[model samples]
Target: MPVLLDLRGAKSSDVAVGTSPISELQACLHSLAEPDHHLESRPWLTGIGESMSPGLGHRLTRFAPLWARRRCRLLLPLSPPLDVDMATELDRVSRLPENDFVAAAAYAVQGGSFDPRGAVTRPGEFVAACEARSFSRGELARSLIDDPGDFRRVLVRTLEDSVDAFFAKEWERIHGRLRDEVEQTRSRLRGLPLAEVLSSVSPAARPVRDGRAVRFDKLQNLTVPLGGNPVFLVPTIHGRPHLIIRGEPGFPVVLHYPVAWRGQPPSIDEVRQRLTILSDPARLSLCRHMVNEAITTSDLARRTGMTRPQVSRHLAKLRSAGLLTSERSGRYVYHRMDVHHLMGIGVELLRVIVR
Candidate 1:
């Protein structure tokens, strides 16, 4: 009879009549299947299905989750490794004062290696590493696993910390930029009611990467498009981005950078006038509360554990003065501020106060 065999990890020709036994062949097959079995065990696959679903690049899903998959596509604008144009933009920015400061700081940490900033982040691995490193510096807890209230507090502190770190120029200019962006996000979300914000956004498109599309149906309610791409928008717990998305749960993708859609910068005088309102302690507190999204009087009372009447009075004064805006959702009203406008004012006031 002709010898027949399949080569596993180990090299083997057709087994002769007296070669390896059937048991050995069985063990080799099992060994070969082990990694695949491990891959299947990941939590992300349980929800949306597995990574081998005939789309995108091979084996990417085995590591990252569905939301992450989408985020990877979304980051095409920021992550140099994923976008060629991003790489060029980074190159041009590298010579700028902001970038030079970033390079010097990054270089100092890398044992004085004079790697070009663009080169440092050109590859996907490097870009991921940079994000990981940035998050590590802030050291936020895994919010997805934490209590919602605690998560929100942690998020807010983290944003405040990010602002402080930026003042110190910790990490680099990119880190500073990311910090500023997150702070803006927190303020933006605070000004609007969570329900209204969530309802206004709908997932318009799925990120098709490497010829594969992520499953976003589960996140239909949470999804919103900032420009053209879909983002799984989650409220900042405390004041941080806490929502997690995945094709499946455990094997999740981390989305970096949440951006707000806005027009050009507001005039300086407009900002200054707002800051004048914020100079008062009561208004400052109100401004902080309105940083991310709007809250109804009842919700604000619950959040602050204040009496509804007192909350309503405070809200009334702010609304009457145009420091905040309110909209009715059913019988209850929700409130939020103009985050970009308030922030510009707050920033300028901070500068003036410090000076």
Candidate 2:
């Protein structure tokens, strides 16, 4: 669902705000609000408040306007083995009051950077841009909006003309500027290993697979190269992945490319320990909701329909045993777990239970 802002008889504005990035950003966001008293009490607001970090929010805010402009369409492709019940479940969740915040945030993170109008008026130009970036512009833009085939050929041509080689060269030059800062920080700081320090300071980068090519700087890092429009490329590996800051074409900004890696598996005892607690149906259910995702205590309680005290007890135990990690997104505390590790334990425990 697109939230159209009414700008009748108004001229287009550039990315202009004089305040400090955060304050200016806050003001811009405030301008977008239409006064939702009901939103104040919803779990979604709390979720966004608690989930959004100042650092992350600032980073995202820089991209929010760009993302909002690009979110012309949102698509979910359905393949065979169609389950009507699955669709029903999705619809139910979509209508939930808590989903609004998440949806808004997801749009900012995923679709905010593209030109939604370009997908239509300049279909050929859009396709060319995507193609130059080694991606499928048609499918991607179509997935976000409505029709793909209708605008494929034209979109490709426009994108080609609009996207130029100079953009990539300019981006690489800017990246050198950012990388220099990282190097300077490295020289000034001491103690921790260089790799760890590098990962720590870079919000968009993480250590993965013992120093393989860093990921998360480019769109290609997350998706497979398919003609028309690219699709998300799910990796075989798991856990919190890393993104590399690499130079890209057509944009003079550092791009985030997400990448994955395979590492040594956890010890058998480690598996047993996590499963030992999660083996319980109630605990397992809680773990499932949290695995690979963060959720606030209140949301967890609401989702499970459990008392706060009950949820608190389970979370405490999980955190104590290192099955979960916690962070403060805003006024709320969120918990996330390693799904691969959790699942491995579950499988092992099931085998033992069956035997």
Candidate 3:
């Protein structure tokens, strides 16, 4: 399936680069909820987990599914300014109508497909319909349908608590980097066609229909007509493994793309360290074995005729180099290669060498 963005009437002015703290905040929550897919942000995730109050932690866990793999669209600002801050965005969310909030939450709970009218007019029938599809977040959905006001209050409070606890500092630390990405993108737009820039944004994007539209290779089939509304390109550090596209009716489409390393190429020393780590034959062999499937150290040792200690030593080197991610299951820990990081090594090395 693919998502097509029709740009027939769109011009250079219709595409803009901007940063939204609300979107970044949602991205951060998604990364925290699904940490296994974002191994690069493990340190930040661990730090936030340790620092958050127990009550906040419990609330976040309760609402994890709302922002985990599919975020509630209402959490994102409808049309954020280029210099939008957290307070302004939160204010936007705090003012959403009860019906609109319920509809958006139901859409998220139903996995991006739901009837807003049904959610608003026929709440019981809507929940029944969701249950027919094996509703996983029934309680949250019910909370939204039965008492949207309370849900909205709790949602706002939880988000505010998140910002106060850690994201305010996180935003301050990364705001400059995000602003730089936006400026660089704007500069590129001055020279390149919008289609070319769209293709360059992600490997999964391609200019289609003779550049009249951009198609993203995604899981859902959707055709979004720009209709002269501006397209906002938001770059985020914590939005990896997910290129978020929110195209609600009557609002500008938002694309939250993943950016590597604060939008800068890795340093020479960083590239050198990774290359050096992968240069060892034992470690290379271990990586090869773990490329397609995660393998336990004991299993890898048995398959390679190496002792457990030797396999562990090699795995540690790969892990330290950011080339491997591990997950513990029962008594054994499974390690897998970080293919994206591995592929970026060559890009980083080339940039360093050429620059």
Best by TM-score: 3
Expressed as tens digits, the lDDT of each residue in 1-355 for candidate 2 is 1111111221212101010111112222322221132222245334544544465444333333322322211111111111122233234324433223223223323333444345445556544554454343334433333443333333223222212312223223333443443344435335444234334433333444453223222233242111222111111110012221211111111112111123333333555666577667766778889875799888888999898889889988777656778899779898888555554555444322221
Model 2 residue 273 CA deviation in Å: 10
Residues 145-239 of candidate 3 have per-residue lDDT tens digits of 88888888898899999999999999999889888888888888888888888766666678998998899867779888876787888888777
Error of 2 at 157 (Å): 30
Name every residue pair that clashes in candidate 3: none
On the 0 to 100 scale, the lDDT of residue 226 in model 1 is 28
Please give the lDDT score for candidate 3. 0.79
* Alpha-carbon TM-score of each model against the true structure: 0.21, 0.25, 0.73
Model 1, 43-138: lDDT tens per residue? 422332332234322222221221121221211122122212222433332333433333322321221122525323443333344345445311
lDDT of each: 0.34, 0.37, 0.79
Which parts of model 3 have CA positions greater than 4 angstroms off? Answer: 129-136, 261-355
